[model samples]
Target: MAFTCTIPAVATLQQDDEAIRITRWDFEPGAVTGWHSHGWPYFVVMLVDGTLRIHDGEKATDVPLVQGQAYMRQAGIQHDVMNGSPHPIAFIEIEVKQPAALKQLAA
Candidate 1:
């Protein structure tokens, strides 16, 4: 079954520029960000210790997160992020923009 949020996750735009886009997500119990894909590489900084369920279409994985923990994911990851905990959880997402020079260097 596809995951749907009864109450959508709250996203606060922290910054948006040519370099990157920063957003803070607040998820209440059973809240979900819905199915989506990242266009660019991004990093996540956990603001609270809680359990999050990440569904990558085929399966769902429960990830235990701790406050201040951070991780990075490459572009094109399609998934739904859900708050699996009973309490509220939050995280900061920073999307990395590849500058023209950086893209060329990677080639």
Candidate 2:
């Protein structure tokens, strides 16, 4: 089932290239990102100290966030994200689209 929301968060594309795509997301309390999946592995750096409510297909999980802290997830992750905090929340998402050759070169 596709996740839908009444109010969605703001997602700004900061950068997009062959190897990566970066987005800055801002959300008011109760705002959602809707249901989605990433084609590449991604990392997220939380911009504020707050909690995010994530629906991971089966259940909803409220996760705590710390400013400047980062977390990563593999590709094909599907979920809906919501700002559970009373205050506004922001974060930077980095999607790695590195090709096999590029990944080998970096290794």
Candidate 3:
């Protein structure tokens, strides 16, 4: 997917160690995170209630989120995310570096 988004979202890296990587993403209304793919599985925790316009390769979809809401996606998800809400939005993204090991620990 091609994104002509001139206003890009801001990503603040909180941590990056052997086991995990953490980042906080903040976006103004109409801001976007240009098309990219994740190298590891990740979880998103919403800090502000808002809607995100997700652009998959083929089409765009709106995902409504509530404050404190959380969701996870696997690696290699190629997509673009835009702040669909009229206000600013922020979310914390925790990317698991060793998903297999984490799963083993849960077993």
Candidate 4:
């Protein structure tokens, strides 16, 4: 299924030579990120309290977000995230890129 809502990247807070990228995403009601995969480990910090539906191809899960709450995930996760609330929602995502060998060594 294709997502048609307009989910925009409201801001790019930072990007460094060390391969770190920080971006802020704003989602209006019913907006979605569409299908995407992360190539590096990343973390998300919730800027507004809201609910999101995570669709992983076959199933969908609703996740509640609290303002100031944060979560981390390793690379290779693919999903389409959609705002499940009537109000606007926003969050900051920080991506950390590391050498594959270093990532394997740390595992």
Candidate 5:
């Protein structure tokens, strides 16, 4: 489904050892992140409960995440994350980073 992104609250949770970076973002129902690409391998931990649909090119996945559940993702992936449920969704996005030089090059 087509959507427009609504600005949401974003906060950096942590960044450690060039191995991982975590951030939290909040979204209301019908909110979308628009098309974007992940720079590093990552994972997401569902914070506030909600349903989300992640679409990537020709494929799509409906993932229902509860508080504390986690999902892993990879770099170079382009996708749109949407909050399809009625309640707002809050989650922590963790990016697994490469070495300094590698990450700088990717950046």
Candidate 6:
């Protein structure tokens, strides 16, 4: 298993329709999300923003995360995350519903 940033929610519903789940993730400098997959295609919108260093197992790069910006990711893309800021980092993760069969793929 790999290390991943913790998901924090002080309150609310864990699941619902639209098959979409939104989450607020915060990370400090050197923070990282272990290699993992969403199991579904989804969108990501940066909220309390910062920069992130993304690792795709094969390569790594830095992506600037700014407020009000959104990015779409392929379902089950195994990648790692890292905080590139000295301060805390935060963002909104929107998960979309995907069929179970398609979720099980080799990364």
lDDT by candidate, in order shown: 0.89, 0.88, 0.92, 0.81, 0.74, 0.70
Q: Taking the tens digit of each residue's C-alpha lDDT, what string does model 1 give over 41-70?
A: 999999999898998888889999999999
Q: Write the per-residue lDDT of candidate 2 for residues 39-91, one digit (tens) a residue.
A: 99999999889898999888889999899999999999999998989999999
Better of 4 and 6 by TM-score: 4
User: Tens digit of lDDT per residue, candidate 3, span 50-105?
Assistant: 99999987888999999999999999899999999999999999999986556544
Better of 3 and 6 by lDDT: 3
Ranking by TM-score: 3, 1, 2, 4, 5, 6
Best of the candidates, lDDT:
3
Over the stretch 1-107, how does candidate 6's per-residue lDDT look in tens digits? Answer: 33345532222334546566766776767777667777878777777668878877776788887888898988868877888677787777777784353355577
lDDT for position 30 in model 3 = 91
What is the Cα-based lDDT of residue 10 in candidate 1? Answer: 97
Q: Which sections of candidate 6 miss by over 4 Å? A: 1-18, 98-107
Give me the overall lDDT of model 3: 0.92
Error of 2 at 87 (Å): 0.7
Worst 10 residues of 5 by lDDT: 98-107
Q: Number of the top candidate by TM-score? A: 3
Query: Residue 46, candidate 1: how far off, in angstroms?
Result: 0.4
Candidates, ranked, lDDT: 3, 1, 2, 4, 5, 6
Q: How high is the lDDT of residue 102 in model 2? A: 52
Q: Which regions of candidate 5 are displaced past 4 Å?
A: 1-19, 99-107
Each model's total of backbone clashes:
0, 0, 0, 0, 0, 2
